[model samples]
Structure formats: structure tokens, C-alpha cells
Target chain A: MKFRMYLMLPLLLAGLTAQGLEPLSRARLLADRSAVTPGGQETLGLQLVMAPGWHTYADPPGDSGMAPRINFKQPSDLRDASWRFPPPHAFRDAAGVTYGYENVALLLIDARVPPDAPVGGNWTVRADVEWLICRELCRPMFATVELELPVRDREVLFPNWTPLLRRGGWPAARE
Target chain B: MHKAKMWLGIVAVMLLGFGARAEKQAPGFELPDVQGKTYKLADNLGKIVVLEWTNYDCPFVKKFYTAGAMQELQREAVARGVVWLSICSSAPGKQGHFERDEWLRRMQSAKVAVPVLLDPDGKVGRAYGAKTTPHMFVIDAEGRLVYQGGIDDQPSARAQSLEGARNYVREALQALWDGQPVPLAEAKPYGCSVKY
Candidate 1:
């Protein structure tokens, strides 16, 4: 019994890395800041990484393919939220032309924290994301991602995600 | 004098192109069903016809089938004297391409009442420019291609999305029955690309 438990542990831990039901693509949430300031803006993102030779579509997926339908449940403390997707590449095949992202795609969302929100409490944001990944065959996959951050007077930036959030010439968060 | 003649030629060509676009005709085709019965587009000329590109293995296609939405639509359309034809364009060894016997079984299990046409060579699909499974086309009684695009406004593969989805095909069919022009003609089709 002890030997069997040790063998299963690695497999169970591996499952945590695969955030989606389908193994071909993984979806997770990331934020550019550890905390958000009252009346300030912060960027949160749904990061999708696909297996080699597999891809997911962008908005207005060109000739065929459905765009990812991601709905974010904004916390009451947030005033407004909007999303951004990186520029997509055109994938040409025998069927026709499609527009999508290969390898990795980061769909960023900008959330505004209301000025009157109580500080010191955590604000949790949840998103329901759906996408179709395709290689030779296609799979419709969905995942629920979440991020929580403390409401602080001063925003603490996470340098690791700041560069990525700024990539592709997306506009900076408005004050 | 030569320049004037060239200008006349260009104007004539432009007018002809516009005329063709206004009354684009659905391409004629002859395809076999799972039972090896051939169906011809010309044979259904005086009747309204619907062409539905389909692949059962596709999740987008299953979105409708699993919810019984597609079957209900087909039944209602057929009962109202509309001809609904579902075509499969997957090539051999590709997804959704099955031998005749298996194909027949799948249709039976799915309770598909419409004719399931086979286009293994994708010739007919290409002729109609069918890019996706569930790509739809509607032809009027005069064989004019009246509508071409997605079946509904909701493109998600989730079965739950069928609720409150504005079914474009159903609406188009209703308009034709009421002697009204289709409200929308073309939409960005959403589905898995037809396996060719």
C-alpha cells in the first residue's frame, strides 16, 4: 500500500500543471501586479499554452473556427473590466484560411479598482473561458480560472508578467 | 478611338460582375447518400433547399446534435416541405469519414431524418466553398443562393448555449415561407474545418 501511494503521487502532481480538461492545451490565470490600488487599474490575463502543432482561434476566427468566449465575473469592488487579445497569425490549410494563435496566447484583461472599496480585504475575480484547439482534429475545451489580490493603497508590480502584458503594442492601463 | 473602346469593355465587365453577384446561383451537384442513392440539385429546383455541411466528429456539430437542436430543426424544416440535405466532406482516413455501413449506423443512432450525402473527394464541398462543418446554405425556389453561413448566432460548442440562441437557419426558413427576403444573407461560419 505504501509503495502504491508513492507511485500515484507524481501522477497526481502532474495533473495540477494541466489546468484544462484537454491535455493539448493548458489554461491558467496570471496578474501583472500582486496588489491593486484603490481607483487604479491592473492587468490580469488568461494564459493558454498549446502543444506543438496545435492552435486556438482569436476573435473573428476568419474563414472557420470559433473564437474563445471568455466571460469574466467581475468582483463588486471593481468598477469596470475589459479584455485584450494579442495579434493572431493566419493559418492556411487545404480547407481554407484561419486566424489564431499557436504555441502561446495571453488574453489580457484590465480591471479597475473602485476608490471607495475597503482596503486590506482581498478581491477575487473569476473567469469562465471556452476555446477550441485544433491540429488535424479539434477539441472544444473549457476552464475556469481565478485570481485573488489584496486591496492595497499602493500597487506592487510583478516584473515577471509586466513585460508580457506590455508586449504586442497593447495600450498601457489608463489611470 | 481605341481608348474609348477599352473603357466601354471595362464598364461592361463591371456591370456583368455586379449582375452575377446580385443573383448568385447555387452550384449544382450530384452526391450519394449512405444507401448509395444519388441526389441531384437540379431535381429540387422548384423547391426551397438547404445544404448543411456536417462532420459528426466535430464538437461544433455535436453541440447541436447533443442538444437535439439539429434534429428538431431538420424535422420541422422537412415537415414544412423544405428539403434539408446534410453533406459530409471528409476524405478517406480522415475524421468523420466512415465506411457506408458505419456511416449508416451513425445516422440511424442519431435519428437523422434528412439525406446524408457523401463527398469524400470534397469536390462538391469545394464547389460550394464550404469551409466548416455546419456551414449552411439556403437556396430559393428559383435556385438562387439566398443565404450562406452559420446556423446560429451562438458559436460555442457548449450544449447549454443552445438556449436563447438566435437560430439563423430557422429564421431564414421562416422568412422564405412568409414570402419575405432573408434578413441576413452571410455570416462568419464557426466550426471545425471540414477534413479534406
Candidate 2:
């Protein structure tokens, strides 16, 4: 029995990874700072990294694909959560054309806290995400990601991927 | 005298049957079906016809087919005396391009009762502004473009989403056949890009 268990362990783990766990894509929550001051705005992001040859769609794919969306439950917790997807590459096929990212994509959200909230409070921000990935086939995946942030009077720099914002801005004209 | 009167009555009935009804003018196209039989839009005048853009490889298409959503709708539409035509605009050497034999086999397995019309050149698809696979269009008995848009309210690719999703095609057809105004004329389609 012990020998059989050991043999199947690797296979079981592989199956989990293949099912929504990703050899294809990983979704992570990021913030500009570990903590934020009351009423101050902090840049938050839902980051996506996909494998080569696979792509998740962009907002207004110019054709039929649905845009990647992120939403917060509370009304004002992530206030002014203006999301702007980086301009996507125009994917052309025999069908027509669509816009999306290959290998990597990031959805930007600006999070703001109400100044009147209690200080030293640790708040868990929950986000619901829905996205479609396609490459010869398509799969719709969704998950709710929670981010814990403590209210403090300090600021920190955004994550390393922020520079990708320069890649090309969204609502951009496509060729 | 009674026999002559009967003959005149039969002639009047025959003339009434040949009377032409007003047509709303859907774009005319003659395409070959899966069995290489020709189907012309003009030939179906005065009858409600449905044009559905489809591609087997498309996941959005799979959503409806795999879950039996689309096939069920097709059956229901046909049973109501509605003419359903499934068109494949996939270009040669592109995705969703299946030979006649393969297409016939797939449709049979899928239990699709409608004719699978081949539109390899995409002329018909482009003419009707077909943007995506699974894009649906319904023409009324008079040939007016009644509804042209998504298949349903829930655009998610998940099959389970269809449980609560409103079937737009069904709604449009129901209203049309009942001689009532179509509630919604068009809704944004959701799916993979239609392979032109």
C-alpha cells in the first residue's frame, strides 16, 4: 500500500495543476503598497501570466470575444476602480480579428479607502474575476481573489510589472 | 349546370393558391447543403428562415453543442414549422473547415436536423454582418430581418450558465410566429470571432 501511494502522488499533483491551477496561466493580486493611508489611492492590479501560444482576451476585442472583467462586492471599497487593460496585440485568423495578450496580461484597478474608516484596521478585499483564454480552443475561468491590506500612513512602490504599462495603453488604435 | 359550376369553383381555388405574397427581401444566396443539394434563400420566401453562423472548432460553438443547447433549439424551431439553416463560413485552409462527409457525420452525431449550408467564400456571412460563430439571425414570414444577435442573454462560455439564461432565439421566434412584435431586435453577440 505504501509503495502504491508514493507512485500515484506525482500523478495526482499533475492533475490538480492542469485543472485551473495552470501550466497555462497564473492569476495574482498586487498592490502598490503593503498598506495604505485613509482616503489615499493605491494602485491595485489583477495580474495574469499565460503560457506561450495561449491568450486571454482584451476589453472590446474589436470583434466577438468578451473583455476580461474584475469586480468588487462592496460599493466603495475599491472606489474609482477604473480598470484599463494594456493595449492587446491584434490577433488575426481566417475568421476575422480580435485583440488580446499572449503570454502575459494585467488588469489595472485603482483602489481607494474612505478616510473615515478606523485606523490600524486590517481589511480583506475580495475580488471576483472572469476571463476567457483561447488558442485553437477556448476556456472560461473565474475565481475570487482576496487581498489583505492594513490601514497605515505610509506608501510603497508598485509591483515590478508596472513598467509593462508602457507596452501600449488600452483603448489604443489597432492596425 | 351543377357540374359546370363545380369546375369553375375548382379553378378559382387554384388561382388563389398561386397568388404571390409580399416578401421583405432577405439577401438571396444559393448554397450547397451537406449532401451537395442546393438551398436558395429566395426559394424559401413567405416562410420564416433562420441563419446561424457556426464553426465546430470554436469553443463558443462547443458550449451550445456540447451541452445540447443549440441542437435542442434547432429541433424545437423546426417542429414549429420554422426553417433552420446552419451556415459555416469557415474559409478553406482555416479552422472549422470540415469536408462534406465529416460535416454530415458531425451533424448527425449532434442530432442537428437542419441543413448544414456551406459558405466557404464568406460572401453570405459578410453580407449579413455575421461577426461571430453562433451568431443568429431570424427573418419573419414576410422576409423582414426580425432579430440579429446573440443566442441568449447569458454570454458566458460555461454550459451551466444556460440554465438560467434567456434564449433569445426562442423568444424572437415565439413572438414572430404569434404575430406579435419582437421584444428585442438585437443584442451584442458573444463568442469567438467567426472564421470568415
Candidate 3:
């Protein structure tokens, strides 16, 4: 057990900082369910934890900056229904106003699993994400994140992440 | 005399309103190049002028520079007798704000052939409403501000976007050369906010 725990340490750390550019931001995928049922709706989250003083842009980044882009690459049986981001904070620059998320941003997407998907198998969803994070200067960073869950006959919510998903359902837009 | 004065006042007000609605005349200013040579906008009134808001450190501007896209455009426009002026509006002590020596080095390394005008005070930039590093403006030979916006449609900072991307500045110049109205006179300029 001790040897196994030592071997798993790096893996756990890797999960925590998965696809992160040093001194910028960490990105990882989170699933609301431990297992997904075929023909059921599921929620997936792309979590971004930015370093202090850095931010990623929202859609329509106002006078300048590019918005974050995500390309799904996994789970052929799953189709994205909708994607939403919580309201972002407005950053006023010398030139104009920019809308972005600072510190931490969780982007949620609703996906539907096809009824014909095979049960007892695993479903993995991968996303290729790109963002331009800026403070004084901007850097274009991209990462690939994956989340895997077993395909079960019944829905099985993952306790830890499900509450977060529920509580953070799209907040009111900022005026 | 009273009626004539009243009519003149009404005409003046109408003219002011029309001027406000019409395309603004490009503001005239004199700025020094990296070599300390002065360039006055009024002196170039009879020639087409292109104003390029640039900041080398910004990734969006860097994208065009690294891909040689921006240089090619400048050369093409200059070869066609259009005066191309690269303006840096970054405030002092900010990114892309460089001394004359540094500016010379950067231009040499980047093979920039056009004159780079320094607007460290940002007066010219603000007058032109330049909000982004790569914001572009084209003035016709008659000194009217004809176009102002992004250099192109691809807003990403990635150099790969240069491939097959439509060059708006080129299109505007082509329209003017062909005596046709510019297809896209204005677009949402995208890039890092000007340091000013």
C-alpha cells in the first residue's frame, strides 16, 4: 500500500496541475457524475485557475482581446447541447473596457449521450482549449483536458463536483 | 439684415451637424520619427496615408511581424506611392515604449522600411481613437479618414492565422485604386489595448 501511494503521488499532482503553463494558469476537466447513463444528460466543466493578476477573456472581449476557444475531441457518442460561462468581471484598461474572468473560472457544458452507447464501457471526453491570458502582456496558451467516466445503466452523481455544478449554474449577466 | 444673419446662423448650424455626421478629417499633427526627422500630416495631404498603431511587445502585433505579413503590406503600400507610417502610442515606461536606439534596433531586426512615428504622449493616438496595438487607419489623398479598424479579420495572436487571411488594409487600398467604395470601411479592431 505504501509503495502504491508513493507511485500515485505524481499522478495526483499531475491531475491538479494538468495542462498548466507555469506561472500562468492551471486547467483541468471536471465531471459532475461519477458514471453517466446512456441516453441521459451530463455536465462537464473546464476549470481554469489563473495566477494572480492574470485573466482570460469572455466572448466579445469588448474593445480588444480574443475570447477563449474550446474544441471537443472525445466521446463520439456524446453531443454537446449547450455551453455557458458565468458572468465575467469588467476590466477597464487605458484604451477601453474588457470583459474577462480572473482568478478562477469554471465553464460548463451540457452534453447528451446517445441511447445506443454501450453500457459497462468507459466514456472519455477530451477538449482542446485555447485562451489568451493577459496582465500587462498576453500569452496564447492551449491545453488538452480529459475526463473519463464509466457508462452505467443509471445516473451516478459524483458528490464532490455535483454540488458545485448545481450551485454555479449560470449566474445573472453583469450589466 | 436680420433675416440674412438668421439664415447664415441656421446654415452654419446645419454645416456643423453635417460635418459631425460625415467621415472625420484626419487630424493633422507633426511627430518625429526614430531618426528625429519630423513628419507632418498636412505635408502628405495630396498623397494617400496609412496609419498603423503598433506595439512590438504585444502578441497581436507580434503575430503579423513574426509572419512577415505586416512588413509585406507596408512594402506593397509604399511601393504603390502610399505613405505608410508606423505609430507607437505606448506611454513612457510601458511595454513597446522604447528609446530611439532601441527603436532603431527593433526596426532593423524586423526589416521595417517605413518611418516609425513616436507618440509617447498618446495625443495622436487618442485623436485617432486608436484603441488596439494593431488598429489601422487609411486616409485618402483628399485628407479624409476613409477607413479605420483591424488590419485583418483573424484576431488571434497565432502566426498561423496569417495563412489565407484577408488583409483589410490591402482591400481598402485596392478599392481606392479601383475607384470603388471600400467593402469594409470599419471593423471591430482586435488586439491588446494600447498601453496608453
Candidate 4:
């Protein structure tokens, strides 16, 4: 029985390692709401769940470090959307002060759809994200996320989810 | 096994304590300014000295200078007999590092009233562990580090926020003038990371 258990342990450990070994740390994309109107303004959420004691640089990583950069790719017919980064926390080291998020940071992005966008279909939204995660040392992480939303005519999608989308820095509407 | 664990815990505590101590002392060094005048920390004794690590290309630095926040601080500190040295530690080929003449031109254009020191090799910056553009430090008359860290609490790239945050340099100078301990000695400096 002992010999048989030993053989099983290696296989179990291998399976566990395989399950745990994700290239990047905790990364997920969440929407304030799962649904949206085809031609309306809605909030989209992107969250990076980093490993313990690791952090990503905030945008424009002023003299401190590299800030997180996001690239959104959608159909040319879709309206270009913008990302809202929250006020960043400052980091100080022997090198100087840098802006970044420690541990887990919630980065909120605002997405807009044209009023004439297609209705009654799922539209694909993809984002390529890159950031530097640092503890005592720094590591660069990249992730690509694709989200699908069910579109409806004029109906506000995820009305209840606005709070989650409001956490990061969002620009005021231009006059 | 219990004894061994106790020994391990003791070692861990000692290591942690050492790390804490390591974080407290200011980094050291020597660097020349825009005129090729070398400024060394040890030479500033008997005077209240201020160190402003700067990068001209950085927007945050621009905000302070363009808005007269840094100059105002420099004028005020100098009036109180503070030696304000603006040190640029940008490495060669980096964004902020410039020739002495170019640096002088930039300073003159910006109306910078303080001595603009150069650290092209970054020897002084590394010694003092100067990290960000606009990182600040205050050394007392006795040549002991009195205060080190950010210039203020706000970290925006906009000069509009300067009025709201408490200026660390001013506070330190005041404390020295009044013969009081600096109320807040160290804070997290915020700005563009020093291009080291």
C-alpha cells in the first residue's frame, strides 16, 4: 500500500503544479454589467489580481517605474473607448518615487458603443494589457482578455454594476 | 526541534532589524552642477542644506518650475540661509542629462534661482540613493540628515496641486530655525522615477 501511495503522490503533485502554474498572476476582466445597449455608454471593468507583495506601475510611471498600458482592439465601426486610471499610490525606493498599485488594484475603463451599432448580437471586445509587477524586484506581465456582451436596443446593460466601474480614474465628459 | 526553531526565529528577527536599519540612513556621494562645480555632502557642514533631485524633461519637475513652486521654495529657503542644490542625476543619453551649457540655458529659461548640480555619472545619486525626479532631502547645520523624502503630500503631475500639499523643505527649515525637531521627517516622495 505504501509503494502504491508513493506512485500516486508524484502524479498528484504534477497535476497540482500544472493547475497552479499560470504564466501571469491573477488576471481577470469583469464588466459592470453582463449586458449593454448597442448604442449606449457603459462601463467595463478590468482587474489584475497580482500575487502577494507584487504591484504594477500606475500610468505614466513618472520617474519611478513603468506604468500599466492598455490597448483595446475592436472593429473600426465601433467607437473608440478610453481607459480611466484611478489616482495612483506613490512608491519610494533608493531610485526615487514612482506611482503604482500595491497588491491588487482595480483599474476601471470606460467603453462606449455607437448608437447605430448592431443590435441583438454579441460584440467582441479585446484588450492587450501590459504592466510591471514589483515587490523587492520587478517583473513585467502581459495579458490579453476578450469579453463578449449581449447587445439589446436602448436597454442599459449592467446598470447595477456602475459602482464597480467607477472605482478608477474616469475623465469628465467634454463640453 | 523547539530549540532549533527558537534559534531560527532569533536569526530572522535580527535580519529583519538589520533591514530596517538599512532603510534609515541616507545614501551618499559627489556630483558637479551645470557649471561643472562639484557638490559633496560632507562639504556642506555648518549650513542648512537642501537636496532637490531633479529631471528637467520630467513633467512633474516642469509643473513645479513652470508654476514657480520650486523657485518659491528655493527663494524662501535661501532667505532663511538654506543651501538649496538642485541635482540632476540623469545618466548620459537619458532624457534629463544635459551638457553644462544646455543645463545653464534651461535653468536660465526656467528662471531657476538655485544652484543646478549635475550628476551625469550618477555616482552621487547612487550614493544618496536618489530615486525620483524631485526627491528631496534636508541636512542640518551639523551635517546630519534631518529630513529626507518627498517635497509634499500631493503627487500629481499638475502644478495646481502644489498649493494644497505641505512643503517638507519649508517645514524642515522652519524647524531648524526655531530649534525644534522636524515634525515630519520622512515621507514617500512622489514623482518620475530618477532616470538612473
Candidate 5:
């Protein structure tokens, strides 16, 4: 039990850091449900955390900033139904104003699952994303995220994101 | 006569190639440094000069200064009889803008010997098309703009990014000083957007 405790301490600390404090940014893909029913829509999201003084560009991140983008990598049958983002704040620069997120931002995507997907089977959805984070200098960050879901009964992780999922449902245009 | 004709054609083609590579006359500017000295670009005519865009708070700039990469390059440039001028184009109330006394103190503390010229209105930065903090430009003795781009190939903000990357600014200056055409005349700069 003592050995197990020692092992779990680092894991707990790491989890906390990943959740709240990261060196630059920490990103993870999440799903609204643990299972996908045939002919149903699935909502996917990226949980992104930014460290102090760092910010990522928003959609339409003005003339000088690069907007963050995500691409589906696996489960070829999945098609993007919609991409959603929260409103971004305008940060004034010397010559122009840029739109971006400060502390954290949730990027959501709604995907349509093929109606013929077999029940009782497990499927993994993979995503690749590119984002620019800047405070003093800028760094381009690429993250590969995956979320596994079952077609039948399984443990659901939706409860954790229920509050956030209830926020704005469509991509924001202004802030 | 045929041999001479071929040589003439070759020279003409070479000149055309040079013309298409974004060369232009360097713009003139008179800006006050932290010490209140006005530096007129025209005053430095007949000597090779390097223009550097800088923001002290920028991580990309730190990647060079913290490692002494920029200082070493500045020393080398001076030794080669080149005048290096560092320009800060951040407008008033922007992230990198600083008051005169504080700016002087910071430069002195960092041991950066070059003049940190203030471009509060961004007129000079716009004239030179400086996009990012640390954008670099090299002007030849004849006042022709010969090179413009990033300091190096790797654009990462981390200090380790310096490890195998080619320093474009250094390479360009060396080539120009050697009286040879710069191998790569222009490369897209990568860093935080200039506050201007």
C-alpha cells in the first residue's frame, strides 16, 4: 500500500498540473459520451489550458495571428458536422488588434457517425491540431489527441464536461 | 567576337537574376536612441550597416541575447567594420515599449553595446517591412538592401533551437562583406509579431 501511495503521488501531481498549470499549453480531446449510437451525432472537444501571459489565436484571429486548426486523423467515416469556438478577446498590439484566448479556451467539433457502425465495438477517434501560442515570442504547437468510445454500454466521461458543454453551442464570431 | 557576345549575355542574365531577388535601396531614417542621440541612416552612408528589430520582453529575442548569440554576432559585425543598429518599433503603450531611462538601464544591464533606437510611431519599421521582433536587414556599402530575414532557420523560442540552425543574418553579412552575392537573399522571418 505504501509503494502504491508513492507511485500515485506523482500521478496525482501530474494530473493536477495537466489540468490547471502547464508550461505553455496542455491539450486533450474529449467526448460527450462514452458510446456512440448508430445514426447519432457525437460532440468532440479540445480542452486547452494556457499558462500565464500566453495566448492562442481564435478563429478569425485578425490579420497578424494564425488561427488554430484541427484535423480528423482516424475513423475515416466520421465527417465534420460543425466546428465551434468561444468568443475571443481582442488584444491590442502596436499596429493592430488581434483576437485570441487568454487563460483557457474550449474548441468543440460535432461529428456524424456512420449509421452502420456495429454495436458492442470500440472505436478510437484521433485528431491532429496546430496552434500558435505567444507571450513574448511565438511558438507553434502541434498536438495529437485521441478519444476512445464504445458503441454499446460503457463508462461515460460526459459528466466531467457537462458544464462546459452547456456553454455556447456554435462558433463565436465576436467578443 | 562570338566569345565576347556569350560573355555579355551571361552577365546580363546574372544581373536580371539579381534584380528579381528583392534588392532595393535601403530607406533613410533619423531616430533617437535611448541616450537621446539621433542616428540618421544617411549619415552611415558608404559603410555597411545592419538593422535589427528588437523587443526585450520577447522570447525569440531572449533566445539570442541570453545565449550571447546576438552579442557575438554584433561583435563580429563591428570587427568587420559594420555598424549594427537595434531598433524597437513597439508603439506607445504596447507590450515592448519602455521609457527612456528604463530602456537605457535594461540595455546596459544586458551588456548590449549597440544603440537601441526608438521607433514609437513604427514609421521606420513599416518602411523596412519588419514583421517580427528581431527581423534583420543588411545594407551594402553602396546603400543597397542586400538581405532581409530571420536570424536563423529554426524559429522556435527555446534556447536549444540555436543548436543546428543556420544563422541567416550572420551568413548574409559575411557573404556581403566578402564582396560576394549573398547565397540566400531573403527568408521569411519567424517570431512574435512586432508590436508595430
Candidate 6:
């Protein structure tokens, strides 16, 4: 009886561990270019990284249950900054209509800084992103990302993130 | 000169073939209803048919149904001699999965007049590339897909937005009735992800 109990202990523990580490079904934002120009409206490209066999709800979840939302927090000096979302794909469930991206998606946000605002140093833009990821199951996750931009007058300084950011979902430049 | 003429003829034939293939007819499917009687798409040829992917539990679907927007659309569509099919593609264990009796109850409660098609296996859904509840597809009298996408311009889950949004189904049906081409055939759909 003692040996049998010992043998079952490891099996039971393994099951608990597996349940504890249930694969995370959430969206991870990977930004390729974080910097924007003072007088120019540029697109801040982001890639939604979804777990395999899982999908993140698209913006404006139509009739479905989940929607991915983005909240921006920038310094008061930075004005007229807004986020733009790419077109969403539709998914169906028994409950109704929903929108999301399966595998991965490239999202573009148009942001602008005030032309006459304070310049000459680095400015940090932060975003609080919330989204729901679902596969056979569903899970919600929240993440915060900070983007550093060098402020300048009449000049745009865009960061070079082609290698790492491209992997996430950034599209190649069109001719 | 003869060889050039032959090549041109071949090119024209290829172009015509490509055009025909591009306008391929929508695939036919048979799905069960709340009573388990199968509804076949082929049987409904020579008439306009609207296929609505649905999930009863989804808030977005609730927005339209609860607001009576979907029923209103259905009534108008049927008045114009259109057959409306509301399909549910939820898997057995996923949210929105329902038995025949439950679906009937829900549809009755929602005051839905259209036939509700049950696609538990999701085979029909996959065949149509249906990704969301409320995903709307319009088939013309010839049984070709004329439109596919959201039902309207507003993708919000709130019922209030329905009034302001342009309903695509109405527009497509109107265009087809008037013998005019549909101005918009596809639009990005917004809603919760389909639980496939």
C-alpha cells in the first residue's frame, strides 16, 4: 500500500503542474517602430502575437464576446495622438458574431505630436493594452508597453526595429 | 501573323476561363434546423437567400436581435422574396452550443421568424469561411455569392448603434431587386471571435 501511494504521488503532482501551467491564451504586442515625428503623422506598427491554435478578438468585437482594446497614455506635451486599427477578420461561435485575428495580425496606429510643443529631448509614450485570447478555451490578459522617442524640431526620428519587430507582424514596405 | 493570331485567341480563352472561375457558384450545403429536418441550399436555387451566422449568447448578436433589428431585416427580406437562414456553428463543448429544443426555445423567445440552421460539426461554417456570428452572406437568384461581410456599417455591440449604421443586407437586396449591381460586396466584420 505504501509503494502504491508513493507511485501515485508523482502522477498526481504532474497533473496539478500541468493544470497550473495551462498554456497562456493572450495577445502580446510587438512594436517595430516606436518613434514618431513632431509634425508628421506616422504609423506605429504593432504585431499581435497569439498562441498557436488561439486567437485574439479584433477591435470592435461585432456580435462575438471578446474585443481587444488599447488605451494610450502620453505626456501632456504630446497632442493629437490616436491609434488606428487594421480591418478585423470575423469568427463564429454559438453565441454570435465576433471579430479577431487568428495566427497573427499587423495593426497600424497613426500618431502625431504637436509641432510647437516642447522639443529637444526624449519623450516616452506608454500604452495599456487589453485583449481576450481564445482557442478551445478563453483567457484575458493585460500588458503595458513604453515607447521612447527623441523629440526634435521639424525632424522625424523613427526607430529601426525591422528585424525584431518584423517577426511579430509588420508588413514589408510596399513599392 | 498566323502564330500571333493563335496566341491572342489562346489568351482570350484563358481570360474568359479565369473570369468564369472567379465567379464560381457558392457551395451547396445541407444543415439541420431546430426540428432536425435538413435544409439543403441547392433546393433554394432561383431565389435570393441570405445566410446569417449566429451565436445566441454573443452580446453583439443580442444587440441586433434584442433591438429587433435582425427581425426587422428578416421581415423586409422575406417580403422581397428572400429566404433567410440563421446558422449556428458552435462546437459541442464551446460557448453557445445548443440542442434542438434549446435553440427552438431561444429563437422563439427572440421572436425570430427565419429558419435557424444548426451546424454543430462546423463543416458548413468552414466551407463558407464563416468566422463570426452575424456574418452575412447574400446569394443572388443564380445561386452565386453576391456579398459577404458584416450586416451593417456599425460594428459595435451596443444596440443603439444599429439605427445609425447602414444595413448592408437591405442595400444588397434592394440593389438586386432593382437590377443594379451591389455597390459594396465585402466589408470588414466586427464582433467577438467565433468559437470554432
- For each candidate, the alpha-carbon lDDT, in order, equals 0.84, 0.77, 0.83, 0.70, 0.77, 0.70
* TM-scores vs. true structure, each candidate: 0.85, 0.76, 0.82, 0.56, 0.60, 0.57
Q: Distance from true position, residue B58, model 2, in Å?
A: 1.4
DockQ values per model: 0.67, 0.34, 0.57, 0.17, 0.15, 0.17
User: Per-residue error at B119 for model 4, in Å?
Assistant: 1.2
**What is candidate 6's lDDT per residue for A46-71, written digit by digit as tens?**
56667677777655655444565566
Model 4 is docked with a DockQ of 0.17
DockQ of candidate 3, scored on C-alphas against the true complex (2 decimals): 0.57
Q: Candidate 5, residue B47: CA error in Å? A: 1.7
C-alpha positional error of residue B80 in candidate 4 after TM-score superposition, expressed in Å: 1.5
CAPRI-style quality class for the chain A–B interface of candidate 2: acceptable
Local accuracy of candidate 6 as per-residue lDDT tens digits, B2-83: 9999999998797445311213587789998888888999999999999998888776788888988899999999987999
True-vs-predicted CA distance for residue A127, candidate 1, Å:
1.2
Which CAPRI category fits model 1?
medium
Q: How accurate locally is residue A81 in candidate 2, as Cα lDDT from 0 to 100?
A: 54
State iRMS for model 3: 1.1
| Docking quality band of candidate 4, CAPRI definitions | incorrect
**Between which residue pairs do clashes occur in model 3?**
none
RMSD of 1: 6.4
Judging by DockQ against the true structure, name the best candidate.
Answer: 1
lDDT of 4 by residue, A1-175 (tens): 9999998998998866644674435556667656777666656667766666766777656546455656676643323555566667787764645676755566766666666668888767787666666665445556777788888765544553544433333323222
Give the poorly placed runs of model 6, Cα more than 4 Å off: A1-175, B1-22
Which regions in candidate 3 have their CA more than 4 angstroms from the true location? A1-21, A74-82, A162-175, B1-22
Chain A accuracy of model 4 expressed as TM-score: 0.71
Residue B98, candidate 5: Cα error in Å is 1.8
Candidate 3 displacement at residue B39 in angstroms: 1.3
Per-residue CA lDDT of candidate 2, range B1-196, in tens?
Answer: 9999999999879743431212334677899987899998888788889989999888778989999989889999899888999999988887788988899889888888889899999888877778788888888877777888889977677667789888888999999888988898777778877777
**Least lDDT summed over 10 consecutive residues: which range in candidate 3 chain B?**
B15-24
Give the poorly placed runs of model 2, Cα more than 4 Å off.
Answer: A1-22, A37-40, A71-82, A114-121, A135-139, A153-161, A164-175, B1-24
